[model samples]
Target: MATVRRKCFISYHHADQDAVNQFVRDFDQAHNCFIARGLGEEMPGDVINSNNTDYVMAKIRERFLADSTVTIVLLGRCTWARRYVDWEIQSSLRRGQYSTPNGLLGIKLPSYSGSFPERFNQNLSSDFPRIDCYARHMSYPSSTSALVDAIEEAYQRRTTHQNLIVNPRARMSYNRQCQ
Candidate 1:
């Protein structure tokens, strides 16, 4: 059985770069399970410096998040506190005039613990009926199939349960204390 490949945009703290790189190498570069886009991939390392939030988000949506169908957040020890991660999540969930919202998925890195990103948390709900959730949070992928399944599930939710998405939270202006 062949695994399905989805276009995935990875969101992670720079602190978790090694882990994120390893993950991409294993699941994407090596196995070709999915198309990976993030820092040093499709996304640029530096964003425009400006006080205008709308401009920045528009640039991000146009350049990085436009083609992605799923946003894979790599949750490391302090990934939840990064402001950029919050914006990325916000951009991923926002429905643009041309693109629909990307499926949000949080993958706990091997070193993950402590708080989660507030914006990412907004879309992730453990309680079910499950109608109020737009994302899935889970531990690291055990195999290519597991990761693909999660991505596919999220991809389906873009159309199946998009109404459940909660993306109205104000964007975080600064990183919070991890503890």
Candidate 2:
């Protein structure tokens, strides 16, 4: 079967921006396997710097994630400690009147030091009865085919495992310190 190309929203920490850029350049631009959309290097100062969580989440959903069907989080060393990463994960999994929740996946980047974003883990499962999980956490893609397959799996899970999502937890107000 031919691989399906998905429109994916990349949720990642700015600290790993370089790696994320490379991944998009290699996987989407070079291979043409999927369409990658995100903030890139532009940080919308007004929205991101706001103290209101609702405002931030709304802006993120409207601008960054509106057209995406899947969310690929590039997990870096400090990703787990970032509140914005948590909000992004929450927004991706949230189902609203105008949008259905996006499929979620976590990609462990080379800078990853065995720490995972707290909110990302809420939706990801590693235990038995795997079908209950809403997200997949995997190592960085080694090839075009690997990334494409993972994206497809996430897209399929949007509906198949929608009910298993655990996104209702309280949003993180401040960044946490990772051990």
Q: Which has the greatest lDDT? A: 2
Query: Model 2, 1-179: lDDT tens per residue?
Result: 67778888888878888998888888888898788777784322233567788987888887878888999999999999999888888889988676688999899999998888877887777778664788898899888888888888999998888889888769888988765
lDDT of 1 by residue, 1-179 (tens): 66668888888998888888899889888888788876644334455678787888777777767878999999999998888888889889887576689999899998898567888887877677754678888889988788888999999999887887788768888888875
Error of 1 at 126 (Å): 4.2
In model 1, which range of ten residues has the least summed lDDT? 39-48
* Predictions in order: lDDT: 0.83, 0.83
* TM-score of each model, paired residue for residue: 0.88, 0.89
Residue 2's lDDT within candidate 2 is 73
Best by TM-score: 2
For residue 14, model 1's alpha carbon misses the true position, in angstroms, by: 0.5
Alpha-carbon deviation at 50 in model 2, angstroms: 3.2
